[model samples]
Target: MKIQKSFAQSVGTLYLVPTPIGNLEDMTFRAVKTLQTVDLIASEDTRNTQKLLNHFEVKVPQKSLHEHNYNERIPELLDFLRDGKSIAQVSDAGMPSISDPGHELVVACIEADIPVVALPGATAGMTALIASGLLPQPFYFYGFLQRKKSSQKKELEDLRNQTATLIFYESPHRVKETLKNVAEVFGNREVVICRELTKLYEEYLRGTAEELIEYLSEHSLKGECCLLVSGATEIAEEEVFEGTLKEQVEALISEGQTSKEAIKSVAKRHNLKKQDVYKEYHEL
Candidate 1:
């Protein structure tokens, strides 16, 4: 009998490798092995990935794969796959497909019948959510919000009635604005704000949306911020308005507004005291 190998038994290889969210311990053993053995690794930046590869002692050749050059880079990465060589994709942090450019290459791999495996590792949103101490029942991952004020407000409006919890990734500078906008569209709903996760001085603050806005307004934030907003309170189908404090507050908080701004909006809408809204929101 002759030894036989079918074409199906041979195939191209692609890998979605996740990097550390913060502490290096978050890296997985499988991720290490795959990066160690892959023919070439496509990283978001050669310098950033080089630091990671240096730390882990992974010496695979890595080139940049980011938004600027994605149009040109995908075909280059795919060529290795077409040649039956394996390639591992990694981001500066977290899973490659998420909020990162590796998804395009992964999609190409899928279209070409390449074997693409995602080795699970760090993801900031899930990490923040798990550590947030807030209810995790059902949540929406909003990713990064739009920078424009009106657009950001619209984003929140779109999720106004979603019963799932809302999660978002925000920059240090933009956290205040995003919270303000969220407060307008979603109203004084509970919010958990996390920042500089897994690093020294990592912070997690939980409070109503207005309270969060007040807090951030006073403090000069210096690191990345992740906002987790509690979902809309259930509304009776017969009821014209969701009409809860959270909903009321959410409706008023806009992108560039402050707690004071949100409070004014709520007070005007409900014919209630600004003091009363502030007191309930802050217990002050």
Candidate 2:
């Protein structure tokens, strides 16, 4: 086990600073202070972070460390730390490494026995999850889903059995499609859509996936989105019949149940609409 005494020694410490997700006032005093005092600030977007720094009157010099450059930048930053010069890492918003850059640098620091300090501050996922009116604890925070339709559907299918509340970060453009996939794979579970968190236009849209899909169809959405989905409730064996939905339907049909009866039973057991079940059963 590696124990880190962040401030005990004078070796350069790597501070993982969390920035405000949307509202500027959400910035923590400690975060501001760290930014003000650190020798160098590694930012995901120097221009974006410069605006925040200017707002808080922090004039620390910054270097870009986004996804493309992190691999080459890690060594240079590690050298700075080795020289006993403290460094601070910040993303465009929220915690540096939560679905953002900085994880690699943090791992590099730990591997090199460098002290790493993390400041607690605003996080979009948790911020939305708590206000989402869903079970906060026992929640799974899956930062961002795959952008491709097939990949996203496969990911959702893998998460189908999780009993914990699910959290996902999604862009506004894909929220509707993602919700539709959730409805198809997870079966119309209750979902809360949190957008523009901590900002003046902050809004939460709560309903079943199907309802949200219809709502999105009528209204346009902007800004980032956090999706909070209720966990899977217990399913009885009798309700499911046997294997996969298709397999179960086939088994019931072989047991003398009509094709229509098998489809209806599978739909009800899985909390899906009859039409959806029919389409899946027939691969339509």
Best by TM-score: 2
| Tens digit per residue, CA lDDT, model 2, 116-207 | 99999999999999899989989999989999999999899888888899999999999999999999989989999999999999999999
The local distance difference test score of each candidate is: 0.81, 0.92
**Number of backbone collisions per candidate, in order?**
12, 0
Regions of candidate 2 where Cα sits further than 4 Å from its true position = 235-284
State the local distance difference test value for candidate 1: 0.81
| Candidate No. with top lDDT | 2
Candidate 1 contains a number of clashing pairs equal to 12
User: Ten residues in a row with the worst lDDT in model 2?
Assistant: 234-243
Q: Distance from true position, residue 247, model 1, in Å?
A: 31
How does candidate 2 fare on TM-score?
A: 0.83
